[model samples]
Target: MTKLVLAADHGGFELKEIIKKFLAELGGYAVKDIGAYSAESVDYPEYGHKAAAAVASGQAERGIIFCGTGIGISIAANKTAGIRAANCVSEYMAEMSRSHNDANILALGGRIVEPELAKKIVKIWLDTPFAGGRHERRVKQIG
Candidate 1:
């Protein structure tokens, strides 16, 4: 099973739950949810940090973080040295994030994107392989 770490603040709680079930239905994914758990108020940075740490520490293959606009949470996740977190608003962005940036973590906007579109972005980001070659050199420079 693919180990997936998930985290979200109150702004993203509902979308996170939806995606959790979506991943479950897709099968072959073992989701570890470190979350706000409900639609109550909470800080995005804490959850984002937790999810990014999980990926950086090798406890999870990849991570998904969510916030109202996907900006704040992704910023937080990127603060973790080894994590490359991408806040993607479209399928193209998602694909490029993985292929060009080799992002280990994906961030989504709960309020900015619809659930179905977000799902598509997630699938594309997960499916796309890193292009390597020049991209590998560039990604290394990011560290």
Candidate 2:
């Protein structure tokens, strides 16, 4: 089973809620919504770290992070060892993030993407598998 870990800051908290509901009921994956339970104006780094830790420790198979601009949270998640998190704004990039990099986490910009688009992106991301041939060596070197 694919275990997905999710977290967000105040800026993406609302979107995260919509995502959580969708994943639990319709996505056909195991989801763990870490926090930022409310849009109460908080820092993204803390939540990013928690989500990253889950992925890094193998507690979760993948992670989804949300922030005002996705850039910041993506940066934070990538800081943890063994995390190959990518911020994807398009369906192509979402697919590539998994196929080429074997990305363990996906980062989304709450203010930048719509709910339907986000859901679609998540589905695409989860469905793709790493190409894992010569790219395997490169991905291992990434961390």
Candidate 3:
């Protein structure tokens, strides 16, 4: 089964929970929630780092991080070496991030993206495989 690590701040807590259930219902993945746990205020960086670390360390094959706008959390995740967290607002971006960039983490805007659209993006990101011919060399240069 595929393993996924998830994290979110207070602004993203609700959506994160929803996505967790959605992934669980899919039945082929082991979803780990690294948390902000509740809708109370929390820092995005903390959760982002936790999830990114799990992915970078190979505890999870992939990670999904969330913030109010998806930008700050992704930036935080990217600070960790070996983690490529892509903040995707569209299905096309999600697919491209995985296929072209080989992103190990996907970042979503809990407040900006509707739950349905987020789900579609998640599905696309997870289903797409990295096209690692020329892209492999490019990804290697990313340090």
Candidate 4:
């Protein structure tokens, strides 16, 4: 089973909860919410780091992060050595993040995209396989 880790700040906590349920019940993925569980103000970096590290250490296969703008949390996730985090607002970007970059973590803005779109992007991202071959070399160069 593929384990997915999710984390968010206060600004994105509600959306994170929605995504958590979507992933667990509808998507049928083993979901872990490493959270600011409620809508209380909190720092995203700490949770972002925990999500990224879980993936980097093989405790999880993928991660999702949320914040007001998705920028800070994405940046925080990318700081971890093995975490390739991408801030994706569309299904195309989500699909490409996996196909081209082999991104293990996806970042979404709570205030940016709607719930419907977020779920769609997640579906595409999770379904796509990394298009290795030449992409692998570039991904390695990025590392």
CA RMSD of all predictions: 0.6, 1.0, 0.6, 0.9
User: How much is the lDDT of residue 7 in candidate 2?
Assistant: 97
Q: Residues 1-143, candidate 1, lDDT per residue (tens digit)?
A: 88999999998888899899889888888999998899999999999999999999999999999999999999999999899999999999999999999999999989998999999999998899999999999999999
**Native-vs-model 3 lDDT?**
0.94
What are the lDDT scores of the predictions, listed in order? 0.94, 0.91, 0.94, 0.91
- For residues 1-143, what per-residue lDDT tens digits would candidate 2 score against the true structure? 67889999998998899889888877568899889999899999998999999999989989999998898999998999899889998999999999999999999999998999999998899889999998899998986
Off by over 4 Å in 1: none
In model 1, residue pairs whose N, Cα or C atoms come closer than 3 Å (at least 3 residues apart or on different chains), thus clashing, are none
Clashes of each: 0, 0, 0, 0
- Candidate 4 pairs with clashing backbones: none
| Residue 134 Cα positional deviation in candidate 4, in Å, after optimal superposition | 0.8
TM-score of 4: 0.97
- Candidate 3: stretches off by over 4 Å: none
Off by over 4 Å in 2: none
Predicted structure 4: lDDT:
0.91
Candidate 4 — which residues are off by over 4 angstroms?
none
Candidate 3 residue lDDT tens string, 1-143: 99999999998888898899889887899999989899999999999899989998999999999999999999999999999999999999999999999999999999999999999999999999999999999999998
TM-score of each: 0.98, 0.96, 0.98, 0.97
**TM match of model 1 to true structure:** 0.98
Q: Which should have the higher lDDT, number 2 or number 4?
A: 2
